[model samples]
Target: MNDTVVPGRGDKGLLRNRVVEVENLTIRFGDFTAVDGVSFSVRKGEIFGFLGANGAGKTTTIRMLCGLLAPTSGVVRVGGLDFDDGGNGIKSIVGYMSQKFTLYDDLTVGENLDFAAGLRKLPAAAAEKRRAELFGMTGFDRPLTAKVSDLPGGIKQELALAAAMLHDPEIVFLDEPTSGVSPAARARFWGLIRRITAVGKTVIVTTHYMDEAEQCGRIALMRAGRIIALGSPDELKDSAFPGPMAEVDFQGSDPAAPIERLRKAPGLLALSPHGMRWHAAFSEGALMDAALSALPVSVRVRKIKPSLEDVFIRLAGGAQ
Candidate 1:
């Protein structure tokens, strides 16, 4: 019924490896608070994720963590260096791939990488060597002469990832990397992300897809620019609905009587319409059993697992 923040779980060794830390981080734009008093830490080699609807400040928080925008308040540390409104230490260890495709359409694949290397100021030989390694790492089979516009959405996505990793930054920030790619492509892109962690690099990604969010080791759910829930997917779900859930569909067209009647039912935790049916959450099995029995026999009640959407609806006040 309240914000869920579970203590860190899984792999004891990794739990101690804190790579990013933030405390009371906040930023405002005149009369608006884009990111409010948020605090969380990311472990080394962890796939940390931020999930929220638009205007929830997911990007604003990411920007602060990446040192692109200095926070109005709070302490931030990346790789154990105090990032108190500084970019020097942050830039050397963080790679970023934005939600939008950043490669030049007219330029060839090689040219794009070259441009990225120039921006990073990598030497000619070092840039070439890193390119070869990244190509092998991402399974990039496309020829260097291939134009960016000629490639598919998935391929371009991978290219963007490769370019982000060109400098071998310790942490990678992926902002909706697979937003428009096919499901298979999304799956493949995730695999690439997994490999990045396998080799001991940390990743912080923001995704709208619930399934994609499930892949994260830990998640911070944001609402109104504040993290309402912080935990793994299962932890958040269990904490959100510490009871039974049921989907009920009325047999008759006019079912207002039962709907209004159940609103005041004792032990009823939540009741709301979801499309053609209504979803209900009860404090326990005893309450759920009694509630179901009190409903009209013509109505159909099916128990269901609580999902992230359910968590969002219950926690964020409404749908995004």
Candidate 2:
């Protein structure tokens, strides 16, 4: 309520709204199951990440939550109202930025903003004020008359976000908003997201980028239409693999032999190819050293911190 997105319930109990909730939500299309009994809750103002590979049902689940598709079974509640009974109500209170850029390429930025404002039924004067505020927040100063196609990818994304929030919706759903943006632009986009949360609006985003997962307050990792892991970044990493990871780099010979040796080493839980090197996970203490020793003398081994990508790959039923 103070216009800042706090994680979970803080000392102030600020996130009482529980902006989005799903329980055993399942969806199927002609016998192909999409979202399979997924359950999660997002607190007001928090950034909740829905992570999955391509074709992992993220879009299907989002559609159900947005009321664009009715679920085959289970329940969904948004903004304290049941999705079934208050689907339209939910739509009114929520803003969604789809994976594809939804702005009209042929229309000027100002025209698109005007159209969104009209759909939301904002008064002309209020629309002007909102546009000014949005331009100021996004630091986008191109003439509003310029066609959306003329703007850079980052600017287009910024405009889409501004359009989505035109009605000051209680919650925003971003489906891979940074997919095509440059690294610098992605950073800028995240800055905009932080600003939205500063205003107490919850943001639920799905992203395939593991580095982006680190940005969320909590991440739900999905696999084959099921949530295989869920927790804060550190919590998930610690609980999933309680060990120090080592990367073994070797040249002048095929790395397969040493990799296979490490795989069979005691206490080694998983071994994977990290680019040209091999990344091995082993529990802390003597076992890790033993696993390192198992590698051939030609291999150069060094301890490295396990990244969210590594964690995701391990949980997605991949080898190590």
Candidate 3:
């Protein structure tokens, strides 16, 4: 078992037990490489974030782990066993929820849970017990008779999660679970994620939301079918952009004008708009002097921390 955490785990160090291991993982389709030499390990009881833009191979990687798709190359180990030898066991121990809602719209919450339990072959009495426990865990108060389609987006997502966990899977993969939900709903959904980990279940999530990425114990940033960056959020930020960062607010009619001007300035590594202000990064030492001297005195500039988005933009070569 490889215990090392690539670039390293975060401050909490909650992800100490390794469960999923991928090495030199690659998948191809004719002339296109869907996943190219991707490798990473996920720890038990940790929230591992898999981040990338659309078509960046995040979903492809997840599919391989779930045994839904076979990799063209590389080794995938789950639960201390290889996928090839443990494919059936892996299927029984892991749950996957795709981006789209998979539950029947006309099915009630309880009915869906029952169907899920049937898929898992849970005994009738055990299924009832697990259903009640999941409802309590998710704070789902809707009537058992209420249709899933009539529920709010947040509640529907909750039901979907409950259905996935009906089999008591040790590892769960959520592909863009909070894609179309409100901020409040997203927050509530993250709360559910925390609860899942608290019970000793490991979660692997793929999300476009940076804020959601911040919640993970560690993340593997993928791009062009490869893992370009891997580490805790803070570690990735520091590693991606080692130089100092500044936020400048100028009294101007157009934010784009300052951005364009700063882009051509000497020693300016990268600059992007941040709400009413603009965040700029400068290289270390003497380079900072030139980048700052070029700024207009009329603008208000202050030192600021480099954000994960800034780091991603720099490492991924563009904003995702």
Q: lDDT for each of the candidates?
A: 0.88, 0.84, 0.84
Runs off by more than 4 Å, candidate 1: 1-16, 251-255
lDDT tens digits, residue span 166-254, model 1: 99999999998999899999999999999999999999999999889889999999999999999998898899899999999995567
lDDT string, candidate 3, 196-283, tens digits: 9999999999999999999999999999999999999999988877888888888775556556777887767777777788778877
Query: In terms of TM-score, how similar is model 1 to the real structure?
Result: 0.90
Ranking by TM-score: 2, 1, 3
Alpha carbon deviation, residue 77, candidate 1 (Å): 0.5
Q: Candidate 3: how many backbone clashes?
A: 0
Q: TM-scores across all candidates?
A: 0.90, 0.92, 0.90
For 119-221, candidate 2 gives per-residue lDDT tens digits of: 9899999999988988898898889899999999998999999999888888899999999899999999999888888888899999988888898989998
Where does model 3 exceed 4 Å of error? 1-16, 253-261, 264-266
Error of model 3, residue 197, in angstroms: 0.9
lDDT of 2 at 182: 94
lDDT of model 1 at residue 18?
Answer: 80
Model 2, runs deviating above 4 Å: 1-17, 317-320
